[model samples]
Target: MTLGMVALVGVGVALSARRSGREASSATRLGLAVVSVLALWLGATALLASTDVLSFRSARPSPWPLLPLSGIAALLLLGRAPLAKTLLANTPRHWPIVAQSFRIGVELIIFAWHQDGRAPNQITFEGRNFDILVGLTAPLVAWLVATNRVTPKPVLLWNVLGLAILANTVATVATSTPGPLHLDWPGAPFTAITTWPVLWLPALLVPLAVFLHVMSLRQTLTVPR
Candidate 1:
């Protein structure tokens, strides 16, 4: 389900970049961007999972490779804007300062919930809430910006919110356990809301949601330098 969402996001990115002012330039760059990021992520995920120091969780380390890779890919995409200046042309994705600031805001929000009392190592209601928040915010913000309903000025906010959601989800998975036990019809609030699945929502759904949001952000929004 999540992989499907990630693929959908890829389509969104392709479509959105095509409409940008630097269409021709973005074409080559976007290809390199996606392909390069994928290669890096998969390659790294395989190598690092066996390492002892960087080990994330004891249960399922499969997604361990994805966390850092995704984080770095996003960080690169946000940071390396200047390199893509020619590709951006009128629709500049330039938001270096804004992106950094947004990332900080998102991180603070993630950590804030921890300040009161940390949830268990298993699935967290707090973490799922963040993913849903980004899922709602990213697409809407993308639509608003693309339609000129809002300024391209808040690109940083959108990206920050999006990536922060991803980062924090990964953080939770790394620290929490899968809680080997399962309950039946527990009348959990999350079950009523349909946000909580059996296992932690972190690895199962959040990655795909994060990618979907990014893709939606690209497809629904068009900006210029």
Candidate 2:
């Protein structure tokens, strides 16, 4: 699932760059840089997880929480960078919204993890996480935008709702995990995601989701009525 999501994000960026008005060489270089950055980010986070640096269940000054928080902050800031501005100006409006369809796969993986006893029920769809709804509706919303069947205002509202859903999922996961923020649930504390492979969920996927939503909103808000 991690690899698949990573690939989907990378491919989406590459395709957008290719389809944009930029010169072919420039687009290729940008795409390669994006993929390289993603690989490096994953490698660094994986190293921290492998060395137990992120497993801070008992540590007072834990780096675990700060890692994802800082990552999310950095990604949000990146949305305002010149490169992001150029990409947003040139890329198709529907692409970012459509890309969010990957969330369906992520929700499926989380459900599987819950059934395996690796994740708490509280973070599953049967419990507090209804993030799957965003995934299910993303494609239809993208189609509406592509065909001009909906106005930018409604699409902007939908993106805001998606952000809200994402925040709820993040809160649920944080509270369920073992830490100072941990809230007791029916089953064991959610710890599997703090390790390698699954660590990418918070480090990469969630932040990427936010970046896409912000980019979509940025584009939608700029469109003339």
Candidate 3:
């Protein structure tokens, strides 16, 4: 599922570049390559988790998942540098925002995990996480931007809202997991997220969602008045 979403984003990026009638610049290529590498690394991590090669069920000072999460965060911070800013600015403004639609799938996966008794309800849409709304409305927001029916201000606000939801879920997942900061819950903690496929939730999808929101906000804020 994660790979499919990554491929979709890659296709969107390629199509956007084609529609713009310009070849991808070196920086754009580099950015895409970096994302591709991260996706591959996440896939490998999932495979390892599936085989029981990596486990975070026990309470530890620092879980192995934190490594990838921190790496992704570092990459996002680096993306804010001048070169990455130029590459992202050259990309279609609507692409990143549209990419957020994948959150719907992420939410569905969480729902399934909850149903299977692997995840807690607190992180699912049925619980405190309202991130599904952001995912569901992503297409509409993208359409508004595409058709010029809305100004950058509204999109900027939407991005901020999306970011907040993303952060909320991240925190929920972190605190709910069986880690040093885990909360004492009645049912099973969020151990599934530390396993196969679901691991991509924090390792890859969350970071990508954050990157999209940040890039969208930057573009929206920099739009000419």
Candidate 4:
């Protein structure tokens, strides 16, 4: 399921780039390079977890390496606005927003994790996290925008809401984890996110989601109605 989501995101980006007149070869190469690097990093993290080297329950609380990496990527994407905007401009304005439908699957996975007691309830829909609403509404909002029923202002508001929801979930998860920033919880800490497959949530999916929101906002704010 994780791989499937990752593949969808990668394909969406590559296809959009190609449609925007980017060289197919260059886009493909770039996509492959990114996938390869992430795959290797995930593999290494999984191996370390299996060896008990990345245990969230440990005394030191194994660091989530991907957090910093994703942060850096976000900074770069935001800092290099001209380059990012140029690439985003070529793609269909609605693709990034529509692609967010993948979050529905992510929410489902979170529910499963909650059922298994791997994740704290605070991060689930039954708790403080309302991210599922964003996932459920993404397609409708995207359609509205594409058909001209909705203006960029509404889309901008939706993106802002989505970002807020994402930020809340991230903060909840971080505080629930067994780390320096961890908050005291009753039953268990968020150990599952430190392991395989789930690790990709913070490592890849979150970063991609954030990028989509940022780019969509940039497009909507800068482009004329």
Which is the winner by TM-score between candidate 2 and candidate 4? 2
Query: Which runs of model 3 end up more than 4 angstroms from their true locations?
Result: 15-36, 47-54, 57-59, 81-83
Best by lDDT: 2
Candidate 2 Cα deviation (angstroms), residue 114: 0.9
For TM-score, candidate 1 versus 2, the one ahead is: 2
Worst 10-residue lDDT window for candidate 2 reads 56-65
lDDT of 3 by residue, 22-85 (tens): 5657435744765587677776777767764457643444365565577568768877787566
The clash numbers for all candidates, in the given order, read 7, 0, 0, 0
Better of 2 and 3 by lDDT: 2
Q: What is the C-alpha RMSD of each candidate to the true structure, in Å?
A: 10.5, 1.7, 3.0, 2.6
For residues 90-176, could you state the per-residue lDDT of candidate 1 as single tens digits?
A: 232321211222323333433443453433312343434354455345445655555567664476466656677567655544444
Backbone clashes counted, model 4: 0
Q: Arrange candidates by TM-score, descending.
A: 2, 4, 3, 1
Per-candidate Cα lDDT values, in order, are 0.42, 0.84, 0.76, 0.76
Q: Give all TM-scores, in the order shown.
A: 0.43, 0.93, 0.84, 0.85
State the lDDT of candidate 2 residue by residue for 62-125, as single tens digits.
4566667877898888778887777778788998999898899889989998898888898989
Compute the lDDT of residue 48 as modeled in candidate 4.
58
Best by TM-score: 2
**Model 4: per-residue Cα lDDT over 1-225, one tens digit each:** 557755665676577667667799977875676567656655765675566676765677677855646554854565366645566777667877888888888888898999988888999998888888988998998888788788788899999999999999888888888878888866688888777778778776787778778878877897677
